[model samples]
Target: MAVGVSGDDLMVRVGPDATDEVLGRPGARIFDMTGRPIRGWVVVAGSAVTEDEALGEWIDEGHAFAASLPPK
Candidate 1:
């Protein structure tokens, strides 16, 4: 899943195992799939994220299918 910050233009996707820890931290707000505010989640980011980070985070399969045309 992806974590997005409120009023900040950044998002991070982490493994299922790290979801709770990441979103459970302070100073971060969790949003639902519809961009609605929720609770009980964590967040993590910064240069420490990695030597090189992608423009955005997304599931490989989700990205692949996003570019395809919808079925009639």
Candidate 2:
């Protein structure tokens, strides 16, 4: 994983072929460098997909990115 910081947003770069099983954790918006949203990027952390059914369908397709806070 590669991380870049742009102002107040955290830019993340994960493996291109990453699967849902690898990035099924919730955080914030998932999009590409071009600013296009990628569906299935907001999967629930655990098996509680039903609670967020819409987000559960997020597949780790294409390059994915998200905003994150710097480690404290």
* TM-scores vs. true structure, each candidate: 0.31, 0.31
Poorest 10 consecutive residues by lDDT, candidate 1 = 53-62
What's the count of clashing pairs in each model shown? 7, 2
For model 1, the superposed segments whose C-alpha errors exceed 4 Å read 1-9, 33-72
Q: Mind sharing the TM-score for model 1?
A: 0.31
Measured on C-alpha atoms, candidate 2 has an lDDT of 0.39
Model 2 lDDT per residue over 28-47, tens place:
34544456755433222233
TM-score of 2: 0.31
Write candidate 1's Cα lDDT for 1-72 as tens digits. Answer: 334443333344444344555464333334454676444333334432333333333333223333343555
Q: Where's the lowest-lDDT run of ten residues in candidate 2?
A: 60-69
Could you tell me how far off, in angstroms, the CA of residue 56 lies in candidate 1 after the best superposition? 15
